[model samples]
Target: MGQGQQEQVATSLAGAVSEEISASLAPVDAELERRYPGDPGTRQPVHTVYVPGDAFAVDTIRSWGEKALTALDTHAPDAASFAAVLGLSDELAEPVHARVRAKLEHEPIEDLRVDFEDGYGPRPDVEEDETAARAARLIAEAYQNGTAAPYMGIRMKCMEAAVRDRGIRTLDVFLTGLMVAGGLPEGLVLTLPKVTYAEQVTAFARLLEAFEKTHGLDSGRLGFEIQIETSQSILATDGTATVARMIQAAEGRATGLHYGTFDYSACLGVSAAYQASDHPAADHAKAIMQVAAAGTGVRVSDGSTNVLPIGPTAKVHDAWRLHYGLTRRALARAYYQGWDMHPGHLPTRYAAVFAFYREGFEQAADRLARYANRAGGDVMDEPATAKALSGYLLRGLDCGALDIGEVARLTGLTRADLEGYAAPRRGDLTASTK
Candidate 1:
């Protein structure tokens, strides 16, 4: 063909074919949008600190911070000493240590749950009722006075037949108390523990819906974390992934799926000595949970270690190493959050989190900057990788692992720009690139 002559384009399909295909799959498109809405782009707390319901007080947050700081002061007095204990790199030692201490002094507990289940055990009806009400009052006041953790609420009993009524009552009293105390706080969180079946999740969602109706609150205003404790929660008798069904049963109100380390291990008959977040059994369960939650709004949290940092200096150091190592391992595996059972665990928790983000800060920022600028680099990153990169930096900033000024300097993107990159659905991100 001559250069000036246009080539004839040939197509067999009708012009309406694309429209017809889209119309045929409209419902599926809607379903995909509804079910896999992607990350909410909210600040996910680094760790959840669970205090027994009866033990929770208005000052619990401050108390935990003080205790953690005291633990740091007594165990590792200086940045170099603390870094030595955790074996942090020479470059990261000073910054990570300083940031960890600053985090403890400022925002020690990110998310807190007043445990009404295993930690509280079985209590008298009236006593339990009073405790639940008190928790609400204290939590309400904490939020009112700006002393509350970023997220706070109760972890009620399971939907099992055994304690179903009690669990319902506690949740009712707590939520009602919050309402009576002047409405729910923005950071309210709830956990439905020991869920073994999807039906239990459905029941919990229904219960929350009823609560919203009763309070005249907006529909779907209440969301809770589903605690996966039983082996049956991971795998049903029918050999399907029960946890996936549970997420669907939540009806878009499931914010997280938290692993219950000890309970899950016990359910699987793992010996106590071998039950841990990094155990093969634990990893398998979490891997399934991660896949189930991926692209969905739900997040997965790792279970806690029972090793408390206490006793002699040497013993505390050993425990710190264990907790720090577990936290770092979890971070690497994309489990951004876990449970901190003891105040003593706080120091090591921040240390591990800060180190993880700091160690990778420059690389992530560079890749994200390159992607944002469309500048070619050694590692070619697509939008999906850009999403991950921006997400990593945002998480680091949220948890105080990296400073805004530094991130801005390196990435040449403001917080808003990072959010723009990180907040979209994965499908949207890739589609836009295409």
Candidate 2:
């Protein structure tokens, strides 16, 4: 062939190859987008405190937090001192402690889950209804008194076949009581644990829709979170990851996916003594949850450390230390939210979260600020990095760890910009930069 003709043929072949590649990859891209659309823009609480249904009262929860704070103070008078005892450097300790104090003073409980499953198991129907009524009354009262937690909800029993009827009945009674009293609290959520099938999630969503219509409440007002307890929830009968299918089944009401540490480990035949949040089984579940919930905007939380902060008065700090280690591990894994079973878990919960935020504060803030200002000349801030930075600032602000002024100072963005960055936005940080 002539040289010019050879060049022309090569160019045409390259174009054809490119087209073929694009066509081949389109389905894979579509499937990925379908599974993980990204960030649902939900408010994720750092910890869920599951108080028993029969005994849940806003005041009581508040009292428990207060007591935990007092216990913390007794162990370590201030954040710096606490850090010293924990072997944390002052740089890390001071900021976390400051945030901890602020959190305790203002909003200690980010999410309060009045438990009906394991926490308050198998109460008589009348008694359960009464407890539901009492919870509704307390929630209404707290709202009026301005003492309610920022996020509050109930943890209904599992929707598995065995307890499906009882679970729905309790939910009905609870919602009915809540409606009669006043209305559902703002940010109210329902937690359906041990979800093993997608059908269960769809049925529960319908139930919520029906309750809204029956009680004249706003449609889609209620959202739910699911617990990845059993292996069945993660692995379908087809032996493929079912996380995406379960989320799809929620039909847009899935706020979060919580890893049930102990239950998950147990399902793997891990002994009770060996069961823990950091187990491989639990980590696998968390990975499945992260991948499935990613790009979908759903919050993912780790399970709690069962090692309660309880012992002789003199040795109580020992348990606190253990819980702190577990909390730190969960934070390191990027599971910002977890379950808190006891009142005493509060101190470690705040301490670990604050510490995690503090550890990355300087880098995240500086990079984000530079990126926002378009000053990171050689340092490119990718979309993923911006999302992470924005999320860090959002969690700090939402949990009272950082305020508007601090966020602006650190990120070079105003409160409005920070709020906008809490979720996905049309423009980049440069659009919101000062």
- lDDT (tens digit, per residue) of candidate 1 on 1-434: 78999889899998799999999999999999899999999999999999999899878888999999999999999988999999998899899889988998899999999999999999999999999999999999999988889999999988989999999999999999999999999999999999988999999999999999988999999999999999999998989999999999999999999999999999999999998999999999999999999988999999999999999999999999999999999999999999999999999999999999999999999999988898877988877788889999999999999999999999899999999888865466656332
lDDT per residue as tens, model 2, 305-379: 787767664466777777788888887778889888877778778887777776777687888787667786556
Worst 10 residues of 1 by lDDT: 425-434
Per-residue error (Å), model 2, residue 22: 13
Residue range with the least summed lDDT across 10 consecutive positions in model 2: 425-434
Cα RMSDs, all models: 1.7, 5.4
Candidates' lDDT values, in order? 0.94, 0.79
Stretches > 4 Å off in candidate 2 = 1-37, 425-434
- Best candidate per lDDT, number? 1
